[model samples]
Structures are given as C-alpha cells and as structure tokens.
Target chain A: MTKPAYEGKQPSFFTTNAEFIVRSIRHSLRNVETMIMAIVLPVMLMLLFTYVFGGAIDTSGNYVNYVVPGIILLCAGFGSSSTAVDVASDMKNGIIDRFRTLPIHSWCLMTGHVTASLLRNLLATGIVILAALLVGFTPHADVWEWLAALGIISLFILAITWLYAAIGLVAGSPAAASGYGFALLFLPYLSSAFVATDTMPSWLQGVAEHQPITPVIETIRSLLLGGAADEHAWFAIGWCLLILIGAVIWCTWLYNRRAGRR
Target chain B: MGLAIEVKGLYKRYGSHEVLKGMDLSVAEGGVFALLGPNGAGKTTFIHILAGLLRADRGIVRVAGYDVTMEKLRVKMSISLTGQFAAVDDMLTGTENLRMLGRLNGLSAAQAAARATELISQFDLEAAGGKRVGTYSGGMRRRLDLASSLIVPRPIVFLDEPTTGLDTRSRRSLWDSIQALASQGITVILTTQYLEEADQLADRIAVIHEGRIVASGTPAELKARIGEEVIELLNEEGEVSHTLTTDGTITSIQDQLLMLAQQAPPNARVRLRSPSMDDVFLALTESADSNSNKEAKRA
Candidate 1:
C-alpha cells in the first residue's frame, strides 16, 4: 500500500536510461555465450586471414597489422547484428511492450540495446587487437594516434549499432534479425580490408574501393601505420556522422510506427 | 472510490477492420474490473490503448485523472501493464528482472534492491530469484512477470490474461495474487477469456463482444438475469440425459425433475446447480452476435 514508495520523487531520464543500459549489459553477462560469439567470430577470422591467407595476400605492410583493424570492424558488425537479434527477441517476447507501458522514456529501450552492443564490441575488438599483437602485429602511432583510433572505432561502433537497432526493430524475428545482421559480415570483405584494391579484379575493384567500410578501415590503418591520411580520416568521420544521423532518425521513426500498430 | 479509468467515444481501426468502434468504459479505483471477451474481440487492443502502448484513432481516454494522449507522461506514471505474454527477461534472474523494472520505474538503486527483495519474497520466488529465468517453470515465469509489474506498484495495473496457458494451481495462485493486489488498494483491469477467472477475481464484470460491451454488472447480477437453476439428469453411465431449468420453488422443481426422470434412462441421478457466469456470458454474447448479424443483413 501507501503507493509502494516510488511516488513523489521521479527518476531522472539519464539515470533511467543508464539503468536500462546496465540491465541490457547484465543480460549479456548472464548469457556469456553472446559475448563469446561476438568475440569468437572475429578472432577466428583474424586467425584464418593471418595464417591461412597471410602468405597469399600480398600487401605492402605486414598482413597481420593490416588485417587487425578490418577484423575489429568486422567483429563490430557481427556484434551489431546480434544486437539486432537481441532487440528483435525482446520485441517478440513482449519486453518492449512492458517498457513502453512503464514510465520511462521510450528511446531508452533502443538505447539500452545499443549500449550493450557497444560494450560487447569494445570487448570483442580489444580481444581481436590482442590476438593481432600476439601474432606479430604492431602499431607505430603515438598516444594521440592511439586515442584517435579508439575514438574512430567507438564512433564506428555507435553508428552501426544505431543502424542495427533499426534493423532489429524492423525485423520480424530473431532469425530474421540475424539473417539481416550476419549479412553485414560480408561488408569487410568488400572493403580494402584484405588485399589492395589495385590487385582485385577489374569488376570487383570499384566495389572494393567505394563502400563505407573502406574509408573507415583505411583511416584506422593509416592511424596505426603512423599519421592518418586526411582524406581517408575525414571520409571515415563523414561516413560515421552520416550513418549515425540517418540511423537514429530511421530508428526513432520505425519504433514509433511499430508502437502505434502494436 | 475515485475513478481510475474513463473513456468516451474510443475508436480504433486496423486497415479497413475497425476493432473498437465508439467504445466507452469507466473503471473505479481500488478494485478489480474484468474485461471479458474472446480473443481478437479487441480485448488486447483496449488494454494497449489504455496502457498507452498503441494510439487510438480517436478517443478521450483518461487514466488516473490524466488524458492518455495529452498527458502521456502522467498517465504512464500512473499505470503498469503485464502483457498477455509474460514479459520478464528470460536471460536474467528473477531478482534481476524485478530490480531492472524497479530501476526503470524511477526507484533509486538502493530502493530497487530493497523493492526487488520485497517482491521476490512476496511472490515466493526466493528460491528461483537468483536462477536464470529460462530455467524457471511456466508458473514461476508468470509469477515473475506479474512481480515485474508490481515493482513500484503503480496505481493501476493492467493484466492481459495473466493466467492464460497456466495450470490450474498456477491459475489459482495468480488469482490469489490479484486478490492481494486489490486488497492493497491497487486497481486491476484484468482482460480474460476465462469465465471462472473473472467470476472469482473481478469486482465488476464487463462482457465485451464484437468490440462492444454487451453487458456490464457484478457476477451475481449477470447470473441473476438468467434467472434459473439448471437441473441436470445423468444415466448410470454418467452421460447427461437431460437438462432442465426452473425457478427455486419446490413444487415447480419437483415437476421438472419428475418430467426429467421419466424422460431420462433408467437409474438416472438428478442434480440442480445455479446459473454460472459462463452461462450468463454465453447468453449475452450469443444475443449480441445475433443482433449484429441481423444488423449486417439489414445493411
């Protein structure tokens, strides 16, 4: 009785959203398999591309060093897609409805999932970086460059996390979300992540050179190699900003539409 | 008691199908009100609109003195909903689920911890509180779902078929929880297709059919409108041979029983029972369905 004690004092928006983010992160902790999956796929790809294809792929720089950034971004993509599946699962199981009915801000639900994705990617990316280092990969940048690379990676994670959030919302089921999400794993292969674009066949060269991930991988590669190419870095930042803006708007609209119908 | 919910001229349409066509309802505070309707009769739609999850095409809906649309924040703070499916996170422990909801509902971390503990103990989920919800039985999951709604105890709680798919014992236990919630002065709007559930838990019953309320009354009132006790005659094989209805007068009852006895097979036993809520609901909805059919033909 007596209003159950949550009356009079309202929870601030920041705390509520943060608390939900913690809940979502806790969900990942409870199911360590999800994080392991996020970590394992990228690391496995790292091992595959490093040892199996390292001799065949002729790059100017060390193959392991060049492949590390691409694998990190690829891991992020996989993680984001699974984030989509998680969101779709929550929607399917009606936890989204429960959140909608409660007093919290509606955006917090999506934000929570995104935050968890970011955390999982951070861990998975860190692990991939460590594995790359163990296999003779090295970074030539100073502290500022390292920080810049981290910032760029974090922004890239956030941008795609938002995109994946919308995908999760629009997807009908967990399987559909994963199908749509895992499909993004192919993106890194199309980018300049592995071999130089000049070496790729004529038909595949244009796609390899032009996709969003190419500039991002190039920017990270330049940052790790030493000073970044202003063109690639600016392009990467622009891509992240554009995708971030577009995904946030699309996610908000899609969520509102879904809420209205259901 | 004060009014907990009020609605007038509510309308909702899904494409060409109008689910709620000019629906109106009012519910008072501090008691259980059953919205009894079959599936797809707009029961879920009504609960959704009331809970502010879905937008109504047009309506003046209010919950806890705030308009559902214009005063969304206030309305949201005033109510909690347990959807038809148990919405507790299966990945988290039961205690974590409650604490998470509590925190989202604006409780401080400490308050959430204490409240989660209180609810875990109250729902008898102490044993399962630390275990992953995926490991829980259906009954435990349902209880945890209900407890999730009660984290901070909003003034009004909407239970959309809380006991659907539950076993008999689980259903009874949920009914007890609903009763306890009402006893604590929380208003409950329970939407159920189960007649027995409504009869046992609801203080007032609104029988909805075809998106419209065909009857609204207390259980006894609805049953009394049927105005007869049924006499059932069964043969030695326990198969019902004949059923008769009559007033409670001894002479009229005797006459009906004698006729039933004569018509029934040898060694038949007779028993009389009062009209139940199911009978009342069936009669009302059946009549409403026919009236709609007639109107359709006329149109």
Candidate 2:
C-alpha cells in the first residue's frame, strides 16, 4: 500500500523550492498590472529616446543601437522592483508565519520571489528588444556575441532581483518597500544608460563611470555592436557576482534573525 | 497516554513588557485542551512558542517529546498551527492552497491532489474551491486555512483563537471539525474567550489571566468548585443585578432569596440557577488579580 500523505518526513530540498516557485509564478501571473507596467514603461522610454532625442544626440543615426542596451537594463530594474513589494506583502501576512511553522528552510520564501522576478524580467527584456528593433535599433553581432549579451543581461537581472528581495524582507510594509525600490531605479539613469559618460561634465563623469550599472551597460553595448569587450566584461561580471553573494547572505541572516533562530 | 506537550517556567518579554510571565502548562495525548483567556492574555504568545514559531526567553518546552529550542524541525514536524488570522494565500484557489501545503509536506503530486479534493469535500467547500481565496467570505477563508494546515495531520495541532470572529453557525461547524480531529487521536490545543466554547468542546480547560494560568480543571470540576446553586436577581433587561451563592439545601436557598427579596427592585425578578462555567472563570481570574495586586503592594 502507498504511504499516507502526512507521513511527517522531510521533503527533498528541490521539491520545497519548486513548490514555492510555482506559488510565486502563479502570483506573478495574477498580478497583471505590474507585469504590463514592467514591459510598457521600457518600450515607451526606448521610443522617446530613439525618435525625439536620437537625432539631436547623434547625427550619425546610430543612437538607437547605442540606447537599446540601457533600455533593456531599465526594463529589468522595473520588473525586479515589484519583487520587493511581493516579499514585503508576504512578510506582513500570516501566511509567512504558517510557512515558518513548517519544517522547510524559510529562505525558500525569498528564493521563490527572486526566481520568479528573474523570469518575468527576462520576458520584459525580450519585449523591449523587440520594440527597439521596430524603432530602427541595429546591431552587428554574430550568434556567439548574442549569447554573451543575453548571459550578461540574465546575470544582472538575477543579482538585482535578489537585492530587491532582501530589501523586501527588511521592509516593514509593502509601500515602504516600493518606495525604497523606486530609489534604486535611479542608479541606471545616473550611469551610462541614456547618454555617454564622456558627454557629461568632468566631475559628473566620475559619478556616472564608477557605478556598477555603467560597466554592465557598457559591456552589453560593446558585445552587441562588436566593440572592444575585454575589460568591461570582467568589471560587469565582478559587480553582479558581488551583489548576488552579498544579497544571498543578507537574506539568510535577516530571515533567521526575524524568525528567532537559536 | 503520554504527555503531548510539557512547558515549565516559560517566560517571554517584548522590550520591557512581559507577555508570558513564568507560565507552565501540560497536556495529555489524544484529547481536546482549551487555553481560555481574554484578549492580550498572552495566549497567542504561548502557542507561538510551543509551535516553534517564536523563542521563549527562558523555558523548557517539549512538544511530542522533542525540545522546541534544541529540535525545532522535529517539533515543527510534530505540530501544525492555524494562527489567529486566516493565513490562506489570496491569489490561490482553495484547492491550490491545500495542494501546495501537501507538496511542502513531502506528498507526491497525485497524492496532494487527492488530499486536496478530500479536504475540500470534507469542509463542504466544493462550490468555492475553484475560486481564488480573495473572493471567499471570512468564514470560508478560515475553513480553507484550517484545511490547508490539515493536509498532513501531525501528532499535535495548535489553533490560536480559531473561531474568534466567526458567526454562531460557522463557529458550530468549526467545532465539529475540531471534534473530528480530536476523535482521530490528534492532540488538539485551542484558545478561546467564550466560556461556552470551552465547556462544550474541551476535555480540560486552563484559564489564563495576566500571563499566568489562574485555574485549570475539567468543566464539571471547575463548576463544582464554585458552589451547587446560585440565586440571581435579574432586572427588566435580563441582566444580572445581584447574585448569591447557595448550598444544595432548601433552607440555605430560601435564606439567600429572602435576603435578596428585600433589596430587589420592583422591576427585578429572581432566578434560580446551577453554578456555571462563567462563575468559575470570573471567580478564578478576579481573585488572581487581587492576589497579584497584594503581592505588588507588599513588595
């Protein structure tokens, strides 16, 4: 005979995380408003930059190619910001307390949110790239270069989404989480997302060039357009790895502390 | 039967406010136990500590023979908690929620689906089972929450204020569900404010007041300790105007009624009643309050 359903045995770790992932994905699908905003906002910004400002900024007509990489990152940032709100909402609800009483690792809660955000943001990134193509954005890249560009984008999304998930765990309320996440959306703008860093004033160039978002944007741009991709790739990978590790550590410590681990 | 839960000198505090002050309690296996307390009496805190959701400041807590602090996973596996609020996910359907918990508890997908269907029918939620829980009524949501927790019945179940805001009919239905669990030999620990709920459901009741148990006994034992009969003066509004305790003798009852008759108002009528659980609860908690106050003054 088959064993009873409530045999009181610990499930495998993969099954635990997979259940949470399914839950998070269902929530993302039901939340249509956030999903639409994540996709539409970046497409609108890409259109505005390509049509209105592309001519004045670049008389050579290569501005759309230059700006698509930054628009992709912006789409990622917008998509990942909702993860903070989702995490904070989970924390505030009694459902989290129920999960804590179960025999699974509570860190699975944040991992589920991070993984869902990564997939959602990737879809939004794909849509934004499609919109850029329609708006005269061109790139001279082989299939290998395309794979490299996609890899960097996925890594950046994973890192930022994890960071936002940690911020959600620390936030006392969903509104506060959204407000904090909104502050992070400004980092890409201050970096080399829209305009080149060299075009800014000398002092402002230092601020724009040194931030993590700048190297990532620069590396994606170089890979897509067949520019020199040696140095910027290392810096971009290093920053994403650093953020991902730090965020994972922070989430583990915070979840344990709040749940009152011995 | 073995002791399902054993707690001794359990103390918990938030900043300067002590929520659970040196409280101790125990329950035997395969019975219904009620923790009766008013709001803010630290009943939820005590339940959280026992479920391994919160750490006690200083205590020896063992659930199902495993120390809560030292063996958290074992204690967690041994117990299922339905918290004060309905913790069902709003986005998921009732069936989906139950299946998710089943999966989390290590059930196979087919087994989880079967269990979800069984619980949904057992809870009489067939009409609302397919809809998202956000659209469910408060009582329906609570039933779903309880069902989710029972996807895999552990040895012990802790329901913290399970039916606090439910209507009378809904409360009755939930009581039936709880009774079924107890009949299955699952040690069920529940907390409530209603004296009738405790008297109707619990095999034993513990009255907690100001972070300590002021009284503990069976329903009949608690009622018997107060007296045999009580003579009460009821006003026009059916409220008790005055009360007097009496032994089970005709003379003692007459004497008390005679004394009350002189002081009774024109709109007041006499009521002869048996000693009730309400009287025991009031007498126990009130005397506990005065005793603590006296201790405070002496110190």
Candidate 3:
C-alpha cells in the first residue's frame, strides 16, 4: 500500500503564509465592487472637500494641502473596512473549519487578510494622492520627507487594517462587520482633518486635538509641509503601535476561541 | 491492523445541552466505519471531536497514537475532514482552491499544480476546473470539496454527512470514492443519517442516538440482532397491516403464518422479508430511549 503523502513532512511557515496571502489577494482583486469603492469613494471625498468646501473653510486656497492627509487616511480606512467583511465571511462560511484542520497555524488566515489589505490600501492611497495633485494640491517635501510620509501612511494602514481584522473575527456576520466598520470611518471627520481645531468650540477642541487621527494627520501634514512636529510624530507612532499590538492580541484570542482549544 | 482512532468517555456540552455523552468508539486502520444516527443525534459532534475541530469536555481521544488535546498538530497531520457543508472558497477557481491547499500541505508550486490537475481530472472536474466554485452546481462543489481534502492524503479521513444533500447519482459516485479511499488502506470514518448509506458502504456500523453509541457491529450482525426475518401481513391495499418476527426457520415462519390466519382478514396477504438496517435502527434506538426513560423513572 502507498503511504500517506503528508507523512514526515511539515509545511514551511513562509510557504503556508504565502499561499494564504495569494488567496486573499486574488479574492480582493476579483471583488470588483470593493476595489472600486476603496479607490473611488476617497477620491470623490477629496474632490468634494477640495472643490466645494475648500473656499468656505479656508480663503488661503491651501485647503487641499491640509485635507489630503485626512483623505489618505480615509482611503486606507475604506480599504481596510473590507477586511472585516472578508474575515467575517470566511468565519461564517465553512472555510475556516477546513483551515483549522490543516497542519499549519490557523492564525495565518488573519495574516493573509491583513497583508492583502495593507497592500491594497497603499495602492488606493497612492491613487488618491495623484488625484489630489491633479486638483491643485501641492507639497514642498524632499525625497526623505516623502519617504517618511509614506512610512507613516503605511504604518497607519497596517494598524487600522489589523483592528478591522479583529472586528471581523468577532462580528456575527459580514453585514454586521460592515456596520461596525462604518462607525470607525467617521473618526477622521471628527478629528482635525477638515479645519483647524482652534476654529471649533472649546468643548469639541479637546476631542479634535487629542484623538489619534489628529496626531497622525498633524505628523503627515508637517512632513509634507517641510516642518517637524516632533511631539505629534511620537504620538502618531505611539498610537499606531498601541492599536497594532492590541488588535493582534484580540484577533489571536478570538481566532483560538472560535477554532476550539485544548 | 492496529486501531487508527481510539476514543473513550467523551463528553461535550454547549451550556446546559450535552452533545456527546460518554461516547466510546474505535476504528481499525483501513476500513470504512460509519457513525449512524438521525439528525441532532450528535454524529457531527462526534466527528468534530475526533478531527480535533472541537475539544471534548472530558475524554481520552488518541488519533494515529497521538493524544488529541496534547498533540493537536500531530492529530491534524493524520486526518483530513470534509465537513457537513461544502467548504470550498467560492471566489477561487476549482483548480486554484486545490492548488492552494496543496501548497499549504507542503507541496512545491510545480508539484501543487501538477497534483491539482491530476485531482481535477480524477474527480471529473476537468471541464469546470477553471470556473469559480460559486458557479458550480451543488454536486460539483461537493466533489471539489472532497478533492481538496485529498490533496495531501492523510492516513485517516473524517467525512461528516458527505452525501446529505446530494442527488442519487452524486451519492452513488461519492460512495464509490469512499470505497476507493478505504481500498487504498486509509481509514475512513463517515457519519450519516441514511440507513441505506451505512448499510451499503460500511464495513462496520455504530448506531448513535442521543449522544451515545447504542450498538456497533457488522451490517449482518445488526440485522440478525433484531431477527433473521420479519413476516408482514398485508391488507387489500398492499400495506403492512401486522408484522411478526421469526427466526427464519420453517417452523418459526409456519407458526407465525398460522397465527396470522386466525385473526387476519381474508384479503390480507402474508409476505416474508429479511431484516434490514432500517429495522435495526428503529428497534435499537427506540429500545434505548425507552430503557433510558425507565432508568430515569427508577432513579
């Protein structure tokens, strides 16, 4: 009799993760509606803010510069929100059970979703920035500054995508996941994305100035405008790191619980 | 052959509802073993526990000689599970799904592709191999799901109701696949609610009812346990009006017919039939339920 094929061989960690990553990327590409929304919605919002609200909010005509960072973050948020739906559907569907029975680590499923979302958002972010440039948004940053700005954007994307992945793990269904993720997209609107925090009432300023998005936006704006907001940079890094760690822990716990335990 | 799976004193509960209660079972290394039960009788739960997809509340479950809870990875390495529902990725093509699972099973990219092609043809999915699974019919999806589990053949396979929703032709095709797997010396543990399925395919059958294995034996043994034959008295409409058990001997059947002649109407016809798995299931489970009730009342 022939021996079973899997005996005496363990799949390499890299190969296993690569397979899942490719699977997720393929799914993301094939889901045309999600791909379109991730790019178009943010671009549309950028256009709306730059054209309609630009003159009323700021007479200096630099509203596009101030708003681009916020729109970039919103783009990442929109792209990452689909991770929640993807993860929720994977869980609710029977596919997760099949992965659980495999010899590889099951948490690799989340890694696939997160990595794919990060890549997709970065592409969408790039497209949104190009759209901003076309609509009179100018930046005075050097090569180093551009790289630094991109690093922050990527980090922010990674953090928020993982957070959405964790949400997907716990959501009862894909629709519920979308609803929960929608609530998080409003964070940028409530922060210092559109106008100066000083223009708001004192009661609302505390929320506008102190939230994570404000620090992140401030850091990005400073980078692109050729200034170093050192304190905001530290706060931005701190916030992204904190969210990344917490969401990773939460996702792992939720996955293990759902897959059953020893 | 040695036992491929050994389980004892398995107990599982979801809140106050117990799904598996003191279930004990074992399977030899190379044969088809069926866990026969009705819906909600915990057959799927038992299969899940054995596959290490669900942890037993308290039990000693050893698969391929490794303890399930202590060495889950090893247990996973030994078995592939085809769940009650088709679990293929609907977004990926059938070939892509198989190739991805192959890659996860440690096959190189080239090898995975080659194996995917082999399986696609083997499962008669050559024409639909490039199509997304969402477009496939239910039977086609089920075939791909089964093929996915076989990408890297494990020593044992757990099939939880593999034919539950399949048509007659698809069901027959799957039965052939199960037989082929067992013939290759891989132990197969399948659960089903269909008596004919268990009777037709299994080398041995274990009847599960209300979270316990009520009886386990070869198909013939189970049928003989009820009686060798059943004598049915049919009415004018050809419906069974009365039935009596016989030992399949001339005198035993003669006695039954004589007794029936005294009371049965003139239009009633006598028919002798051999016992089937259906009779064993109804007789065994009904008695088990009543006995448990009696024990409860006594307590």
Number of the predicted model whose lDDT against the real structure is largest: 3
In order, the candidates keep a fraction of the true contacts of 0.66, 0.66, 0.66
TM-scores of chain A across candidates:
0.94, 0.95, 0.96
Model 2 CA lDDT for position B75:
90
In candidate 1, position A82 carries an lDDT of 75
Q: Of 2 and 3, which scores higher on TM-score?
A: 3
TM-score of 2: 0.96
Segments of candidate 3 deviating more than 4 angstroms = A1-8
lDDT digits (tens) for residues B1-299 of candidate 2? 88998989989998899999999888899889999999999999899899888889998999999999999988988889998889899999999999989888878889889999999998999999999999999899889988877888788999999998999999999999999889888899999999999999999999999999888889888887777899888888888878888876899998987777687766568888998888988989989999999999999
Best by TM-score: 3
lDDT of 2 at B76: 83
Span of ten consecutive residues with least summed lDDT in model 1 chain B: B239-248
User: In model 1, how large is the Cα lDDT of residue B22?
Assistant: 84
Q: List the residue pairs that clash in candidate 2.
A: none
User: Which digits, one per residue and each the tens of the lDDT, describe model 3 over residues B86-173?
Assistant: 9899999999999899888778788788889999999999999999999999899999999988888788989999998899999999
Runs of candidate 2 exceeding 4 Å displacement: A1-6, A260-262, B236-239, B247-255, B265-268
Better of 2 and 3 by lDDT: 3
Q: Is candidate 1 or candidate 3 better by DockQ?
A: 3
As a whole number from 0 to 100, the lDDT of residue B10 in candidate 2 is 89
Using Cα atoms, each model's DockQ against the true complex is 0.60, 0.57, 0.60
